[model samples]
Target chain A: MKQFQYVRPTEAGLAINALLKDSGAKFVAGGTNLLDLMKRGIEAPERLVDINRLPLKEITKNDQGFNIGALTLNSSLAEHKDIRKDLPLLSQALLAGASAQLRNMATVGGNLLQRTRCPYFYDTSMPCNKRLPGSGCGALKGFNRMHAIFGASEHCIAVNPSDMNVALSALDAIVQLSGPKGKRNIPIQDFHRLPGDRPELDSVIGKNELITGISIPTSALKHVHYLKIRDRSSYAFALVSVAAALDLEGTTIRWASLAMGGVAHKPWRLTEVETFLAGQQISAGLFQEAGTLAMRGAKAYEHNEFKLKLAPLSIGHALSIASGLVKA
Target chain B: MAKEKTSKASRRNFLKQSTLITVAAMAPPVALKAAEEQWDERLASAIENVPLNIEVNGSVHQAKIDPRVTLLDFLREHLQLTGTKKGCDYGQCGACTVHVDGQRINSCLSLAVMNDGRKVTTIEGLADGAELHPMQAAFIKHDGLQCGYCTPGQIMSAVACIREGHADSDEEIREFMSGNICRCGAYPNIVAAIREVKGGSKV
Candidate 1:
């Protein structure tokens, strides 16, 4: 690992100020991702602002919903009573990700802010737009199997690899952030951005911003499912995954939100599919049609043509599971 | 969760006197403690060498280390407690799995400073003198290891699995133990060992 300076502030305000004011520092919450990147030489922060000492480790009950402090470990979130009871999908997604040991230490904030796992992005030898602007994305034509198909820009095609964020997207979660100025809330759906012009700016979060908490509002989605299709059942990134939550009256769908992972710059929200599935009877054919609509605008490269097929099937299966038409 | 956090004063009692070695040990006896202390006083103040007063099993230790150092590294390197392995430095792997404050966590992922004044039960601390932890004993009895690199991680994760009520059934054990990967393909024996231990009592 590259040698660097480290700071551990005792208070949350001091930590945020240190993070925002320091031009050469990056916040180290759980250090699961940051430390890994640092060791791999992917992220070289001249000064590591260790925010672990900050009081960002609380899991509390708020009037709006469960106000999970940013530094709250993933295990705490998964096992939280309110989350398990109300937002089981989030819990399930968290459980499906990484391992028990990681979940216990990986914080909710770091999980959301974790970088993409694209082969090119990870391998320093390869060219990746996400890693270096104007360097070109090697995944576009080389080993593009895992690259994004929808809402992708020519600059980058690396897919968002967060299963928790996928569920959070379907649940319409909100992020609370503190910075040099003050604090602001950003909706989960709007938190991440497409690699439109600058693939570097993965999220709307400013460099100075430190995630404080995440609020997940209550919703009447009768069913929720996080369907991950990967090579292995354990510790594997998704080949194509879908998180769908639905509200059903009798057999017809009243409300729905679908987010596709391993196939987009962000956890993709299928508004077109949601609009099509509304007021429609829940059926395999209808779900298939909605899935088709969801992946309609997908653009496949030389290697990721399978996603054109896998994306729709996965989404359809997730919608079926979320609508109570299939088993988990 | 209030019950989860033990008070600092209560935790201090857990550390043994032996761990409280004098700060005199930090310097050469010949060199004056005041010597060169003025040169980097600012740098030293920037990073305080926090004392980790923790109890591992029945024994307590006070580790004076860089607060940024992780508990996993502190145990493996400074303390020379290597029973807990470091597989994927990232929390993704359970190689450095251990019970901190009575809960399982990826030691490599947590800063040692964060665990100050907490009870830490590592694999080395799990056994009673010469006796192995039930999970460790069961692994040996069932031949649940091959290369043996991942055994420590698997065993630690298994203990947490049973404790968390995730080892209720064969399928549950398989799903729950998915967190700990055994590339040696001794999963069947590992499952059998965990089942044997859990079925014994207090499952």
Candidate 2:
């Protein structure tokens, strides 16, 4: 790793200013992903503003639901009584993502800002548009079994490798940020961007902004499931994961929220399928139709063509588990 | 005879001067603390070093280190605590697992300066003098290690797993201990060791 200066800022404003002052500076909380990238020489920040001292480690209740501080560790969030009871999907997803040690070190804000695990992006020798703008995409035609199946452009085909982000999208979570302009709340869907011509940019967050917390509104949807399909049963990234939640009135679905991971540049929220499932009776045929509807615009690459078959099956299976028709 | 003696004297001087220069340049400034009361200016000005006040095991260490060194390197290279192994260096393998503020984390992923003011417990601190920790004893009794490269991390993680209440069953122990990879395939034995330790009740 390259030599760099480290600064610990106790206040949010100071941390933001420290990052804004240096164009090559990065705010490091857990250093799980950032340090890994630095070790690989994929990222080299001249200065690191350690924001672990900032007062953003609380999980406070609000009129809406809950506002989780940015520095709240993933393990703490997963084991929180309220989160385990009310937002079990989030807890399950958080636990399902990394190991116990990683969850203990990773923070809520750091998880959202984690980079993709695309092999091309990590290897500096390879030409990746996400790593270096117009360098050319290596995974577009190369071994792309883990490439994006949705919201992908000709420039990039990398997917967001976060299990927590998929659950947040399904829960209607809002990202709270404080920047030079002021404080603002961005919905989870708008926070992460599709890999368009600007594949280098991961999120809509500004260079000077600090993620304060995440605000999740209360929901009537109690039945929830976060189904992560991977090569192994644990400690591996999702191949095609689904975060499903439903508000059921007896056998009929009153409301629903669904999102997918490992198949898109961002959390692919199934709004159309969500709308279709509302007011529909829960049945095998209905869920099968919903699964088909969810795959309306999904496009697959050469190595990931199996996802076309697996994605629909996962959707149906996840919905079945979330609706209590099948045990997860 | 005079010319040969003169060249030999110059060679002796060159050797002495180079040895002194190497020691001044390469060794940590803490090594020179006993020899001089004042800090070395030439060594301090070569590279920027951050002041780190970290509590490791049970002792507090105050030193100036390059900001780039990881907590794993600090423990192994600086503190001379080589019990914690560095497997992948990346967070993928858990050979560098250590407890920071009571929670286990991959030391390789953490910077030493970032751990300022934090209490860290490595494998070296697990045993109490001659007495071994329950987890360490269980590992030996159950033959949980073959190569033993990932033992420290596995034992550390196992201790935290039981404390966190995730070691109730063999399945839970396996899932929680999945982070530490034993390339020799000692997972079944490791799980057996953890189960035996948990059966005793309380970590």
Which predicted model would earn the best DockQ? 2
Query: What residue pairs clash in candidate 2, if any at all?
Result: none
For model 1, residues A148-260, the per-residue Cα lDDT tens digits are 89888888988888889998898889999988778899999899999997898889998788898898877788598989988887778888988888988999889888888
Each prediction's total of clashing residue pairs, residues at least 3 apart in sequence or on different chains, is 0, 0
For model 2, residues A233-307, the per-residue Cα lDDT tens digits are: 999998899999999999999999999999998999999999999999888788889989888888988899988
**Residue A307 C-alpha lDDT in model 2:** 89
lDDT of candidate 2 over B1-203, digit per residue (tens): 24534543454455445545656765576447623643333343224588999999899999898888999999999999999999999999999999999999999999999999999999999999999999999999889999999999999999999999999998888899989998999999899889988899544
Provide the RMSD of all predictions against the true structure, rounded to 1 decimal.
8.3, 8.8
Highest TM-score: which candidate?
2
For model 1 chain A, the run of ten residues with the poorest summed lDDT: A1-10
Any runs in candidate 2 off by more than 4 Å, and if so which?
Answer: B1-47, B201-203
DockQ per model, Cα: 0.26, 0.35
